[model samples]
Every structure is written in C-alpha cells, then in structure tokens.
Target: MRIAAGLIAVVAVAVVSSSVPPEPRRAAAQETAVTAGATVETEPVAHSGDAADDPAIWFDPTDAARSLVIGADKKGALETYDLTGKRIQRIPDVYPNNVDVRGNVVVAADDDTDEGVLRIYLVDPTTRQLTSAATVPTRVTAHGLCLYRSPKTDKLYAFPNSVSGRVEQWELTVRGTVVTAKSVRLFTLGRAVEGCVADDASGALYIGEEKVGIWRYGAEPDAGRSRTMVDGARPEREGHLQADVEGLAIAGDRLYASSQGSSDYTVYGRMDNKYLGRFRVVNSGGVDGCQDTDGIEASSRPLGTAFPAGVFICQDGYNLRGTTVERQNFKLIPLDRVVLPIGTLPIPYP
Candidate 1:
C-alpha cells in the first residue's frame, strides 16, 4: 500500500561519452547490467489490461522479429508478447513469479502450491505453450528465481527463496523442449535467498537475498569447497526482505535487484556486495505504465516486432486489482532511462 507522486513525461538525454563497455562475450565476467541515465526513446508499446508480475525474453538469433516475451499473471497465467508488446500466446497451468530462458526453452518457478511445494514449468518456444515439467515435493516460499547452466558440467541450477534460509540447486531435465526438475545440490546463503544469475564468463553465480544482503556464490567439483566471492555485505531496504523481492539479472559488471512497493531498483557490485545507489522508475506524463514491478529481463534481441538487446523489462503487479474482481494488467519497464545505449523502445506487451 504505497503511493508516490509522478513527474510529467519529460525525456532526459545524457552524453554517453564514456567508452561503451565491452560486448557481452563469454569472457567479460560482468554481473549486473547498469542502466545509468539510459536514454528513453519516445516510442511507446501498447498492451491490454494492467500487466503485472515476472517476464523473460527469448533470444532469437535466427529471427529477431519472431523473438518472444513471456510474463506471469496474478491468476497463474503466463502471457507471451512480441517485441511490440503484442499478445502472441498465453501459457496456462503456472503460478509463476519469475521466468528465464536459458537453453532453447523457458523455465518457470512458481510458489502457488499449498504448504511446501515447488512447481516448475517448461514453455515451448515453437508452439508458445507451457508444460508442467517438474514438481519438487518440498516447501519453499519461492518468489525470485534465476536459472543457470554450469559451464563445465552444463548442469542446470535454480536459485529460489528458501524454506530453511538457503539456496538449493536441482538437475533440470530438458527433453525435446520439455524440462523437468530433480534434486541436484543445495547450498547455504547468508539468509533467505531469491534473485540468482550466473556469470557465464567465470562460471560463477551472483545471488541476492532480500534482507540478508547480496552475495556471490561460487563452487568447485571435487577438489575442494564452494566459496563466496562477496561476503558480509547486504543491500539496504525499507521493509522486510520478503516484500516481494522479485527481480534479478546481470549484464556487464553489476547485479540488479528490485522489490515491489519499494519503488526503487537496488544495485550491487559484481566483485562484491557493496550497496550501490538505487534508481527509481517513474511513469510521469500520464504514461500508461504500472510500477509495482515483479519481473525483469535483459536482452539485445532487436526492436520492431521482437524484444531488443540490452532492453530491460519488469512487471508492475497490483494493476487492475479490485476492478470487477475478475482480471488485472501486466506492466512493463524500459531501462533505457537509467542506462544508455540500451533499449529505448517501450515494452509493447499484451
């Protein structure tokens, strides 16, 4: 239950004289994608209803226009959108908070189960449909989730909110566009963990615990033990860590995390969990954007008919609530304003 004033729609452009950071190769080892004064192009994408919850962008190296955008709804529906925010598909049978597309498929981790239950769904890019993949019979108040592929073993790992205050990993099975989740390994975080992203460059991971703080979780095979690249550092918040610790993603050299109702994006250094300034996203000027963000994704796909690269999108929950007591809307955030050379195009989603 938070409300804030809005500024009129005024586009601000900053000089990007600094050398554009290195491309997202497999060697940069950068973590969070910084959106610093990222300019916002004046274009706007339209969608139906109030868009809320998590979203993921699928990279289409072959067809950028055919690329995909998927998001979570308040009623267990995963809606698909094109780059222009056009409704392409609506995947069902999911209680998802966050979704990620890693290896040719979409994986969703949602906590709509009673008691302790973990339900993961796999979405087919070809058909724009969802299949109930795996159900781990455990109790985790899952909210924020990140999926990663082990650079060496190529095993899949999921970082979700903990029932016992630690992050766990599982062996995700992908068979002909179907992914099922199974037990692999479980690890301890400083506290209840949520946001997760892997540094493909170093085969390491960056984890964000809402209250416990930001952490760098890394590991080895048999020769020794896992280690924390960044320890004892935490992100500052105004409320409980559980206040919808929803989004987590990485780009060049930083980690980005957000919480609903807080109205600000939290930042940390990839090398260490030191608190960076928080950037607030506002929809001034009667913009039809909603702000209670729940999901976020970064991609350099392209514009026009598909999600573009370096484009940052998030979900604004609580939209259209109590409106007919029937349905709600999904909100999108374009990160071009806080960061530059990024995607300026509006999230035209359905």
Candidate 2:
C-alpha cells in the first residue's frame, strides 16, 4: 500500500521516471508542525514540460536583499526568483536541469544541448542577476548538478550526474574573470542518479539513485568509490526511503531527501546519515501542499523578518495557489519555524 510515485506519471523519459512506489499514504493527522506554513509561493510554470525540477539558494555576501533562488525550468531556461517568489530574471534556451550556487559562482546542467556540458555563471553584485561565465563539457549527458566549495582547501568543484550512472567531478579555476573546469574524478553508481548535494564542511557528497536510495561518497577528487547507502527502500532495512528519491538538500547537520513514493520527505543526520524523522509540506496560507517534489533547497542565512533564521524551498508539483487549475511552483518554509519547534536539531547557523 505504498503511496504512488509523484510526477513520474507525467515525465515521458523512462530513465528519469522509473521509480518504486512508496508505502500507502499516511493520514493527514500525522502531518508535523515543521511544515505548517510557507513564507512565499512562486508563480506557476508548465505542468508536464519537465519544468521546475530543482532549486539552489544563493546568498548575497554583501546585502541580504540581493539573495536569489535559482532554479531549473528543465524545458530550456534557468530562472532566478527573488526571496518573495517573484521572477526577476530568466536565462533562456540554456536547457538547465539543475543549478547550484556558491559565492558568486553559479553552476547549471545543460544536458539538453548537443554538447551536453555544464555551464557556469557569475552573479553580478551590481545588477543582482546572473550572466554567462563559462562552460565545462561533461563526459556524459548531465542530469543532476551540484557545486562544492571545499571548507579545507577553498577550491570550488562541480559535480554532474548522468542518466547512465556516471558522476563526474570537475575542479573549477578562474583566470582574469574567465572560469575553466578540469575533470578531476569520475565514478559510477551503476544506476540512474539524479538528485545530489555536497556538504563542504563535512566533505560528504549525497546522491539519490532514483529507485534504489540515497548514497554518500567523499567529496575529494581522490576519495575512492567506497560508499555508504544512507537509506534504502528495502523492507528489512531500518531506512525509510520509499522509492524514486528525487532531491537532496543539506541544512546544517540534517540531510533532507524527497521520498516521492510516499509524497513525504525523510530527514537524516548529515554526519551519521541516520534517519531522524519525516515530514511533508501541507496546504497552508491559502496554498496547496507540495507533492511529487523533484528538487528542494535550503539556506541557513537569516533574511529579514520573513526568514530571520533562514529559509527552505521545495518544488511543488501541483500548485493551485491563486488559480483554479494546477501547475508547478515552489514553496518556501522558514528554517527557524522548522528546527526551533522540532527540538531535534541544534541551530546550525546560529
């Protein structure tokens, strides 16, 4: 009685849509207060265009007002939304599948192009917008993308996952404002891999292997293939990941992965990869609950009154906020509201 898989019913690509259904839907009475209300909801995008797949939170070093939520439309664009969920800029025809931001550097997957490369962009502090900076050709068609800025070495890295199971890591070097990438490490999960995130402080890389589960690897180039499956769908295991694990996001010491099979999110300890609890976004503030979420992101940086402690963003598969019909959009949750009330986690940023 697993909950049915989410957006896979609409995704035409077999490699991406193949997923194991989650256990039956849990009752609404079990919903947690951690996801009670969203601070903002973005405008709707296409329903079945493979749009609004992933999001990356970009923090402005100089001004909190300059922060942005960068997301992949998947169809052919990289969209930048203000903290209020308004579209401020759109980079068209890039065919971005996923995006990640660190400092001024922005990395996105252009797997739809014939070249199938990873594109790098830099945020302009003056304009508070993104501009094309460079491109790194990947060995395989990129499906998932994440960026890592090593806390130890301070070197920047880009990781892109291919539908065929290849994961490539590239170290980026900048010279005279031009960014260049050199592939440093390549590995395989031997299964479809999409959602991925890297913890710079811990030097850990977490990737979602669709039907299988979430796996973690070392973030270093020399870090070998020896890995750990943080959670799985197997019944005998204590792990709670159902199937078709779609997105991975790290906030402080907690790792959040979407269990699309059950339409819920499983939370784990980022260090030990231990399952702590689970929660789902429900209808609040006149907005519908998010289901079949493909991509999710969070930042621990305080942003004024709305998100004093930080913010969390999840892709809403079926958004019916203002209109009668449904489309895809994003939901924002305050980090303080989630962690403070739960008493499960120590505030990471504070």
Candidate 3:
C-alpha cells in the first residue's frame, strides 16, 4: 500500500501491532529460484516518488490485441496503457490506492477526501476511454480494492479494504452512463490488510492480512465474518508467504500473491487453495526485475502476438533503466514465461 509522504513514518509504526511477531530472517537460497522476465514496461507515473501502485487488465473481447492496462497512481491519478506499454490516458486529481475492473466498469479506492470513496468509471469499448460515472463514499479509509461479478447471481460487487483491516463489500448497479452502489457487508480482518481478489466461479474472497497470512471468506452479501485460513506467515509453519502480503490476482485455476518481504510471488490452486509454488521476476532482456512489488494482475486470455498465452502485469516498486534508478512504473511479462516446478494445469477460464 502507498502512503502519503508525510504519513510514511506514522503508518510504519501503526502497521505492526503488539500481537504480531517480528518476521524471521530467511536465507535467499531458501526461496524459489525460478524467474520470469518482462517484455514491456509502462511509462513512469507523473509523481516522483512512491506513485505507481496497482493495475487491472481490461481484456478487449472482440480484439484481444487492443486490450488495455489500467493502473492507480497513488500520488493522484489513474493511468491507462495499451498492450505495447504506451500511456493512453490519465485521469488526474484522484488519490486512488488500488484499482479493479470487471466488464465495462472500473472501480478505484479513492482516499482524496476525509471519508474514503469508490470512484466509478465506465469504459468505452471502441474508444477505450474511461468516463467518470459515480463516486460512492465509504466509512473506512480505502487502501485496497477489487471487483467481482458473480456467475451465480450475475451481479457486480466491489470489495475495498482499509489499512485498519476494515473491509466493505458493495453491490454496484449501472444504468446507461450512470452508476450506483449500496453497502452490503462490512467486516474487519483484525490487522493491517491490503491485497484481495474474488474467485467469481467459486464465490470465494481471499484477503491478505499483512503480518498474518491469507484468509478465505464467502463473497456473497450474507457471507459475514466467517473465514478459513488459506495460509500463514508464521515462520514455523514453513509457508511460502513472507510478511507484507501485498497484491493478489487470479488467472485460470491459479492464485498469485506478492510476497513483498521476499521479493517473490507465491501461487496456489484457486479451486482447492493448495500451495503451488513461487517465482520471481528477474532482470533480463534489458528490463529490470521487479522488487518490493505492490500490485499484480494476470490473464490467461491471449493478447496479440506479443503475449500469445496472455500476460502478467506487475507494479515495479524500484524501476530501473540499465542500473540507473528511474521513477516507478509497471512491467509486462508473457504468462507462458512464468514456469512452475510442477507445471500449471489447464483450467477453463471463469
């Protein structure tokens, strides 16, 4: 999660509570060595420091080659880029921390006001432009956000979580150019939390409690607080996850989470919630590797000749250009390059 420059020190202290234990040190050799490389990298965000945050892929159904990547510039805007990594649009003055897109609707967790808000936008398929639709206010301080379109109910929902661990599920409705929302459920995960993704096919919502591990909950409006631990951060448990579990993404039957403290990503089975493996994005082919990553998005849908088997987008916290430090940006890697020790099984897209 990106914090304002002035509040960085304050947030650092607030994130680690007394109940949480300090992270244990793990040797670099102990972590997975499998690596993937990026083929395309987006332009840096307008702000100088700690700006670029999360990304959501908008797959153009009619023409996958025309798909776009929408990202949140925590400093104050939302930027969109085409598959070739060219910046297409920038909606400024909105301090959004996380972003998600489903169908024609794009939602961002905005903290520009005293009360957190969800900035809703409608995407023009042909033009690939985002038009402001509505801003629904929430009680919590929005930090992480994701969208879900239930296959069972055919209704759209947004899950936005705050740094305080409060999560709110809102049901969204769109009519023509206008959008509306109603708060359906609210609950806290008991620690600072951020990353979240919903499995529309299984109706499961997974939340990452920064210091703890991943937890699963039902995505239905009436699902309530009941949850099951999918994995843990406790060193003794020997789990792949490290501290500060950041962004989460689901592609095919696989679930990916950014293990920030370790500079790697851990994968799991979307259907069974079983640990799959871990991999890192390393420097190769002129593009720098991803380190201290914050958000990531993956799609199994082929996008042109560049990414025949789809793509994986990551927010590179430490963007570099031939050893020269540059302003933060996002990186694009072909999904097929992400090879796991136990090869990924084919699962029909949801």
Candidate 4:
C-alpha cells in the first residue's frame, strides 16, 4: 500500500538526514502462536530504507522451475527474480508502489506520473524477462493495484486504488504487442485505502481501508457500490486484523493479508470470510524471519521440488542479519508448511 503523499515526503526528509536506521518493532502476543520460516530470500532492493513494498508470482506452466517472482521497489524500479532468489531483471525510472500479474502481462501502480498510471509489460516466456508494452493512465492517484481475469468473460481487468479511497476498474486489452485500457467502474471506500484483490471464481472484490477494515464488493463492471464488511480492525470489533491492513492475496480457499501493525499474517475462509488463525515468520535455518511486512502473495500450483505444494512471498520490512538490520527484501516460504484451517482444499491455479 502507498503511504499518503504528504506523509511520504516528510518521511523521505527524515530518512535523508538520519545516518543510523531506526530499530525494528517487536511483534506483540497474537491470537495464534503458529510460526514458519522462509526457504529462500531474494536479493535486497537497490535503494536503502523502506523501498521494497509488494510482490507477484508468475507460474511458468511449461517449466515449473522457470517460474518468476516480480517485486516493486517504491524507490523507483521494478525487479524480477528467479526461483533461486537471484535478481534477473530491473526496470528503472518509475516509482511503483504495488504490482500484480495475469498470464504474461504484468502491471504496476506507477506513482511517478502526475495522474497515476499503470506501467504495463509483457513477460518473455523463454527468457523470463519483462519487456515494456504500454503505459495506461488512471483516474485516481494509484496507490495499490491488482489484476484479475474474469472467469465469465475471460477479459482482463485492473483495479488501481488511491490513498483517498478512490478505486477505478479498467478493462485491459492486448493485441499483438500493443495494450489499451478502458474505465468501467469507480467507487469510494470512505477512508484511506490501499490493498485489494479480486476473486475471479466468485466475482468478489476485497478492498482494505487502512483505519477501518476490509470490505467486499462485486467484481463485475455493472455491480454498484453496495458492499458488505468482511472484517474490522481492533476496538471496532473482536477481530484479528491490526490497523494499516496492507497487501492481500488468495491461495486456494484461503485469503491471506498482512497485519502490518502486529508484524504477522492473518488467514480467512474465502467462501465465508471466517477468521481461521494467524501466524508469524520466525528466525530458523540460518535465515531471519519476516517482520513489519507490507505486501504478500501466495500460489497453490506446484513449483519444483522445493515448493512442490506452491510458495508464499512476502516483503520483509526489516531485513535482519542476526541483530543487525540490512536492506529490505522479500522472503519465500513453502506454502505446505503453513498450517491452515480444517477442510481447506488445495485448489488448482486459476
């Protein structure tokens, strides 16, 4: 999720003036004590400080071992990494807060432009590298973004949201190497909002309001602003979600979200939105755990032997090497190691 423009500028100044980085926050007691560790850690972002924000995993159907993981460096670049955690490609000169992929098309919410735009790219299947295709402008100041391919129509859609709660849905079309987008729907969520994900199978859209909670809306273009509350932050109700709800992703019948305030991840039943449990990544096997996470992504498709049941990727806010803090980076966890609620089935890739 993108921080408010005003706050970002102020924080930027402080970071520039300070020689020493601040200490990382500790995680408080949670409802569940379950924990897991990352199997792979990506190379740190090019810039220092809070530059790494979100990630997206692209499954290579032809060759599972060739699958790629793409991430956004809010400090002005988008990076692609291989299954072994090596940085393969870096596209510079753009401030992308969040990124998502559908098939071969990768879209990032570019905040560098005056009126936020979506930087589009098509991945080369053979080389597994991203090639710039087009730049589509958005109506709102794009802070968060996610892509969806409809099950009914099979048409691609992009949901780019702003810090002011404005979200616009655009239909994207690709012909040859050219790409275009058309606005189809718009709505406001009342407060500062960011993270969002679309359930193509159920036609459901989930949006996270930083101070409030997550809301459910229709993914169809004609579906109006009518929404239902899926879950709320503390003090509002008895729930697991902490304030500043950030990146969201779906794996099979479960929905995963970054509980930013507590430095953990919360799980819910995708069908009923029922709170299942929560877990934190802890230090293990020579690699440190993830803390103060900002963005997360998960997949259920088998990807090689290491991640046979799939993998989960998260942006580690405080990349620590023992007690000392290092540059921010993403962690890859084997999904099968994460214990889920009872009756959760392994749904195939969408």
In angstroms, the error of model 2 at 232 is 0.7
Query: How much lDDT does candidate 3 score?
Result: 0.82
In the range 133-208, model 4's lDDT, one tens digit per residue, is 9998899999899888888899999999999899999999999789999999988986888788898788889988
Each candidate: how many clashes?
33, 6, 0, 0
Per-residue lDDT of candidate 2, residues 1-350 (tens digit): 22333411211222322232122344222433234457688776543434788988878777776688888888867888888888888888778888888878889988886657898998887788888988778887888988887878889999999878889999998765699889999999988888999998788899998878888899989898989888885342345776677888888667888877666678777788777767667666565666678898877777667787777788876555333334577888876555532543443521
Tell me which residue pairs clash in candidate 4: none
In candidate 1, stretches whose alpha carbon ends up further than 4 angstroms from where it belongs are: 1-51, 114-123, 133-141, 177-180, 219-245, 259-262, 268-277, 284-286, 301-309, 318-336, 340-350
What C-alpha lDDT, on a 0 to 100 scale, does residue 31 get in candidate 2? 36
Each model's lDDT: 0.50, 0.75, 0.82, 0.81
RMSD of 1: 10.4
What digit string (tens of lDDT, one per residue) describes model 3 on residues 1-350? 22223311111122333322122234222643466788999988988677889999988899989999999999989999999889999999999899999888999998778878999999999999999999999978888998888878899999989989999999999999979899999999878998899988899999999888889999999887889988776443446777778899888778888887776788888888888677777666777777778899988788899998878889987776654557889999988777354445366342
Q: Alpha carbon lDDT of residue 152, candidate 2?
A: 83
Task: Give the residue spans of candidate 3 off by over 4 A.
Answer: 1-29, 234-238, 339-345, 348-350
